[model samples]
Target: MVSSKIIDRELFERILEKKNSLDKARPLSAEIVQKLRQEMEIEWTYNSNAIEGNSLSYEETRRVVERGLTIGGKSLREHFEAINHVNAIRFIEKLVEKKQKITEQTILEIHSLIVKGIDGVREKGQYRSGTVFIGGAVFTPPPPIELKARMLDLIDFVNKNPDKLHVIELAAISHHKLVWIHPFVDGNGRTARILMNLLLMKKGFPPTVILNVDRQKYYRRLKEADRGKSKPFVDFVARNVERNLDLYLKAIKTGKDEQYISLQEATRHCDYSQEYLSLQARNGKLEAHKLGRNWFTTKKAIQAYLKKHATKNQKLKFIQ
Candidate 1:
């Protein structure tokens, strides 16, 4: 729904720069890629399900998905949601490896994997047969009778104009439009997210996971999209993708010792208090950024800042 003219050109260029840097670091060792993929499987599942109101914590989701352990006090549906989302991620990986095209059947297959054992067994891969309403949403989906044709049109539009927009924009718009269609009775949010990642992976970018912590902003952006102004939502998705690119690039470009750690953790290697380091980061004295209200900087960045400061202090002492 975002028109090209409305896109923030500066932000778009910044994401492309990050993405291009990622591509230059290509052919990451298979082992590293596999490890990152495994970690992402659990994290992506947890965040995606959490956004949809699933109560499983990050640790619980990891246990359920990895160990097949039944968590105490958690509903069977919650467990299924966790397991189904990982399975869906695996399915998407296979599709990416095969370089599959995006189509209605492909979308349904992904949805089927997502809702396999959940309450909507009968409607797992099927569109809605009746009206449905999104709670707290300002816009309503099209009537059930019009759903199929509209979905086909969406697919047709995507396939026809694959090169008309930036890849990130393409993925974000696909995500917004799918949510607008609201084809299925349930799992629409999760499925749209998976579809968005599918588009990203197809374009040779890493699959992005929108943190559950950003759910409020996420929904707010979607609501903005409903009002026929989609730049906000598109920018939201682009920021997520940028964050993901930063993560991947940091992992591959740096050695095992150069981790992107919290400021508090960075203090273990230095004599600065957490407050001081955070203040430095806030004032741009350190190369760091806030992720979810916490400042994160690499040891390399901190070391660089400290070395520069030490040199400056020595010069001042000599002058005295």
Candidate 2:
């Protein structure tokens, strides 16, 4: 067995620290929480559905979710997907509020809302009775007969958290494992992502969205997990968790350092070009996150990076 670490321990701890900061600031005014929640719900719906190939643009999804207005050019399935995802998120929020345990029925119910009008009633929340295959996936899902047993085992693993994994790790693994099982004929991916956030929210983390812009890298990480290198997938999820935490912290203005600016705006304060900063962000050298196609980082992060590198270079010059 490769004893290689399964996640960036430093980054993971940094995320936990941010979660701690958010927790300490809890009981944020109801109005602020409500506004942030509304924004995140729309974003979560749009991105999750888009990742599943829904054609509605972000604005169309906002209209569908917020105003119940359908787009003229989009198909009925796409509209339903956007609306249903919002409904599913609301359902998960209620469960989180009630501190409910994640049962098999709960999973089915979330899936039910996700595919309500798009899929037939028999397949709405029900596990597939026939085999299904994921295009571009490295492995086939377990056969239908194995799904129930596999789901039960998954529920046990999540509920018990037998390995005592951190909540983030548990949620990430559960996300991949549910997709690995591919229990439902459709809506498996959406359900797994929702279920993953449900675990996070129940643990006091804000709702995390896996952006549509990340669709390709997201699949690649999942495929890596399938090949027994789960670290990449876990790190990917953790980065997203940090992103949402940054959003929450910023929304409340929890601290001055939490202010995040777009890479373009951030460039005005730093020596490096936006492209170079984006590269550093992608390589994990900078503390930043992507919102859609744009990357955002704090002035503090830029200053820290420059300070660290400048000192390193000065030491090398001294040695020379």
Candidate 3:
């Protein structure tokens, strides 16, 4: 059924062009790259765990992962989830650096890292021993007996079709298929997301963080994929990927200075509501464009607009 789904070639090419253009721009220094990776490591772990109902707040997750401090209200498992995810991220980074191939062994090892202390020793890194149902999901995962065969088949498909589909499509489909399998008793979503990033990183793309704000939409897209339509999920993933690329490109060009940002982000630096900003963007009063579904513009653009509109008695406020 996934094969039957139509690929949005136009959208895919558009995202690819943005990605390639960023790659062609000035190369980021190693220090800047590492700093960006560290920041994303925190965001990626926090968002991935939060989507799965982990009780740790983003700040709490940062404390647990970076500061190694325990939160007062969070359970040990929640803390472990945060810590383990960071370790798993580190593991994946090593795997990427080594240019490792995706295989059952790698998947299991990653799972092992993710559930090291949270799951039973027997369950850690092992496939589910029984059928699993996702609450409110439109489709159920395959039974345990079929998981191995299905996983192998999926791997074979990915390996054989490397040249058939674009890398983003390949990674997106792999993510959907992994979730459909629901290979482990726990951590399936987290593992699938990490693995998807693994594939993306392998292709020299940045890792995507599906923000907690988008959790509902993320699940909705996954459900759409389950019903044999993969485009929505693929498009969702691509948008996130595009957003990350935009951020990284902007950061590299601006050296952590004020740069292009989404309307929601821009609101923090200005007096305009997101709705007002959207209108301004639509009217071309602000130099911005709709990337995916959100409008993006630089701080300089906003500053210029303010200066042009400032009254003689009023001083223009710029983003600081």
Best of the candidates, TM-score: 1
The lDDT per prediction is 0.82, 0.84, 0.80
Of the candidates shown, which would achieve the greatest lDDT relative to the real structure? 2
Deviating ranges (above 4 Å) for candidate 1: 1-6, 254-320
Per-residue lDDT tens digits for candidate 2, residues 1-320, read 11113558788778878987888987786865876787788889889988999988877888888899978988888888888888899999999989999999999999999988873547888999998898899899999899999999999999998877888888999999999999998889999999999999999999889999999999999998998888889889989999999888875655555566678877777667789989999998988865544576777777777777656553233210
For candidate 2, which ten residues in a row score worst on lDDT?
311-320
Ranking by lDDT: 2, 1, 3
TM-score of each candidate?
0.79, 0.79, 0.77
Q: Which residue pairs come into collision in candidate 2? A: none
lDDT of 3 by residue, 44-145 (tens): 988999898997887788888878998897789899999899999999999999998778888888889989877454688888898889977987788899
Candidate 2 stretches with Cα past 4 Å from truth are 1-5, 119-122, 254-320
- lDDT of the structure predicted as candidate 3: 0.80
Backbone clashes (count) for model 3: 0
Find the number of clashing residue pairs for candidate 2.
0
Scored against the true structure, residue 12 in model 1 reaches a CA lDDT of 70
- Put the candidates in TM-score order, highest first: 1, 2, 3
Better of 1 and 2 by lDDT: 2
